[model samples]
Target: MIAQRKDDHVQLAVEQQQQHSGRNQFDDVSFVHHALAGIDRPDVRLATSFAGLSWQAPLYINAMTGGSEKTGIINRDLGIAARETGVPIASGSMSAYFKDPDCADTFSVLRKENPDGFVLANVNATASVDRARRAVDLIRADALQIHVNTVQETVMPEGDRSFSSWVPQIEKIAAGVDVPVIVKEVGFGLSRETVRLLESLGVRAADLGGRGGTDFARIENGRRPLGDYAFLHGWGQSTAACLLDAQDAPIPVLASGGVRHPLDVARALALGASGVGVSGTFLRTLLDDGVAALIARISTWLDQLAALLTLLGARTPADLSRCDLLINGELRDFCADRGIDPRPFARRSGGLDVPHEMTGSTR
Candidate 1:
């Protein structure tokens, strides 16, 4: 039990990093600056909406907590930040609520704090449909995030190691729920095949919680049996590769994992993510400095996002998806392994249709 609690806190700490420093995997691509004064920066609108909810910016607060007493305070602060920022916030796994009815308050505090703000409820893919359904109702969630983390589970001492037999479960949850269902990866990222599988389930969105941000395997290594298994820490997909795999996906993608700042948000939006999710960085701030600090930091991030979008000549999130980005080095090689022809960026033939909302324009 102590190990599980530690695991939970470690997970929260990782989310804190993602929200603060951000994962630096995908911001290398430069947005071509527009010198001509055709449009004023103030004229560019950064407002956008997703899943029937409006956001001042395209960045969403990803899932973070609710399994313990300590998380109650974390959720409270996080909730306050979300309400102030006007971005959708997702609650951590609601399994704890179902297991311990008394702990339901930890998860519900998010909705209670932000009555009108968008809140997404989450549950593991391995969880039963009834549990998933109950979680959605428990929080009156705007949407449901069914997270898949087979690799992470395998490594963790008390993690779930089930294979991909949750399709029927997911379909049942999706069919039963009125709100949109989003399937997400924990850290290892999703493949094109998995994205196709998710699309086939009629799911609406995917959060490619790719690697190079938080090392869950490494976290697990600290738990026990620290040997050859430690090498598994290097395993998993970078955020860039996951984005490329999910590009042209049937459903909109919510790029996540290592994203840290406005520039990362720009890169993700340009890569085709309808929006980006920041959990680690924000969680850290909430844990360390409290809600006020988190809000201030996120406000700065939003400002950076607005400035980036204006510089990219993107008037809105949709325009950010249409801008071009130059990919190179490890990211380019990662894309190639996944069958994406990076030559498009190299040949300047407009090879890849980089998501405009996330990337800066190169033209």
Candidate 2:
């Protein structure tokens, strides 16, 4: 059953059904460009730290497929790419492997291929401390990603039914694990309330796995008869809006979801993200162009990211928040309605107009 599920995930992944109606919320956000950035592209730095581990760039490979031969090949190639590029990589959920020990090699190969590189292990938030430990040990992980997918799971026909005890279980694992625990959302954006809850539980980092990326609702629903859950296809907030909520978060926020362009990564940093994660897009690149093309694409993205930072007068990821940004369109209203105060986004340049609330439809 586990093996078949893994193959289904891989097969669904191969299809390009990850599209959404979201403007990615990025369409409403714009950064103030400084004509005299002063620093050269070579001077820009993206190196960052998360949970005491250093990353060559402020980017990571978000969780994806595993537990089958096709996925195993993808993981091996992704591992080799991470090894060569010096970027951190994470495996898909390891629950399948734990259920069937024969599938362990699928995820284990990531660590074997990248002996010294940073590899992250993933599991559900309700997983036990022992299971979390086993997952970490199985991959020699530097950090662990506990994905929160209540909505996704509820939508999956064969998904876990009990979710009432997830918080206590998460609290236990967060305290028990030696490695850093990154509480991640699966495509649905994390609100400040959620971040506050995790902070109270002692979690130090969060991946606001916002929407406008892969629609897990669409994916899981596609597996059902007639893809019936189509009405909920556009559920949740965009990644950009989620990052806005994280602006004042006590802990560092790692932004993910629909992070298609390198420029969007810059915008994520501008909203105070400590790092960024890209999954579906990276997977698509690998599946379409092979490992060599995937590596080249990563190189191009890193380069373009540096150039974008230079244009924004940010010499490093740390400098990104200093630049004033403009929040236009419905996103501005989202910030206003949520009490986030979009004024500050424009205040980086001193002052600007704060749009009035729209009475009716907002894109």
Candidate 3:
């Protein structure tokens, strides 16, 4: 039953990708071009550190699928892509393995395929400390992602109804787990309060899995007999809004959900994301084009990211924080309503003037 459900999730997620059409918050955030900048493409760096590990690229392949033979194949291909591209990869929820130990190989294949690369093990908030450790050991994960998906759970037909012990459970797991723990969201974005609360619980980082990528509510609703939950389709904060809300958070904030291309990744980095995760887009590419094609695509994204950084006058992903951004449209309205000041983002460059020669222009 669990394997079948995992298979269903893979199929539905693919369908969502094919049918996905709409503007996301990424469209609202634009970069301020600095023609006076003197930066070269070879000087741009994409390396980043998150969840207590160094990443070759700020972008990683986020959690997608595992647990069944078909999904296992997907994981294998994703693992190969991650290995070839030198970015981290996360497994889908390993709750299935705990239910039936026979399903362990499905999740373990990630480590089997990418033995030298960074891997993150995933579980829900309800998991016990023991299970969390087992999950990390199953994948030999460098870090663990404890996903808190209240919205996904509420919408899931067989999802958990109680949520009283989630915080305490997370605290316990974070305290007991040997590796760094990253509290993640499935699709619903985490707010400022939630990020602070996770920091308080001693979690290492927060993956703000903001809405706009894969819609779990729609997926679960599709599994139902009636499909009556269409109204809850766009129920949570978008990835851009969530990043704005998390500006004051002291812990490292990673961005996922709605991250489609290199420019979106650059936008997230400019907005203070320590790392970015791409799931639906990467999954669609691998499934549609094959592993070699996916590798080529990711490789191209890495090069494009470096080029984008150079264009924005930023030398590295972290330097993106210093690049000026124009936050307008719905995203600007979001910052206003959330009481987050958007002025600072616009003023990051401090209005410096560069010489004509430095700008590569002859006046």
Using lDDT as the measure, the top candidate is 3
User: Per-prediction count of colliding residue pairs?
Assistant: 28, 0, 0
Ranking by TM-score: 3, 2, 1
RMSD of 2: 7.6
Which residue pairs collide, candidate 2? none
lDDT of 3 by residue, 302-350 (tens): 9999988887778889989988888989989998898888877878898
Candidate 2 error regions (>4 Å)? 17-22, 349-363
Question: What is the lDDT for 133 in model 2?
Answer: 97
- Point out where model 3 deviates above 4 Å: 353-363
Candidate 1 off by > 4 Å: 2-8, 11-23, 50-54, 225-228, 343-363
Residue 55 of model 1: what lDDT? 65
Per-residue lDDT over 106-183 for candidate 1, one digit per residue giving the tens place of the 0 to 100 score:
899999999999899998876777788789888899899999877777887777767767888887788778789999
- Model 1: weakest 10-residue lDDT segment is 345-354
Candidate 2: minimum summed lDDT over ten consecutive residues — where?
Answer: 351-360
Model 3, residue pairs in steric clash: none
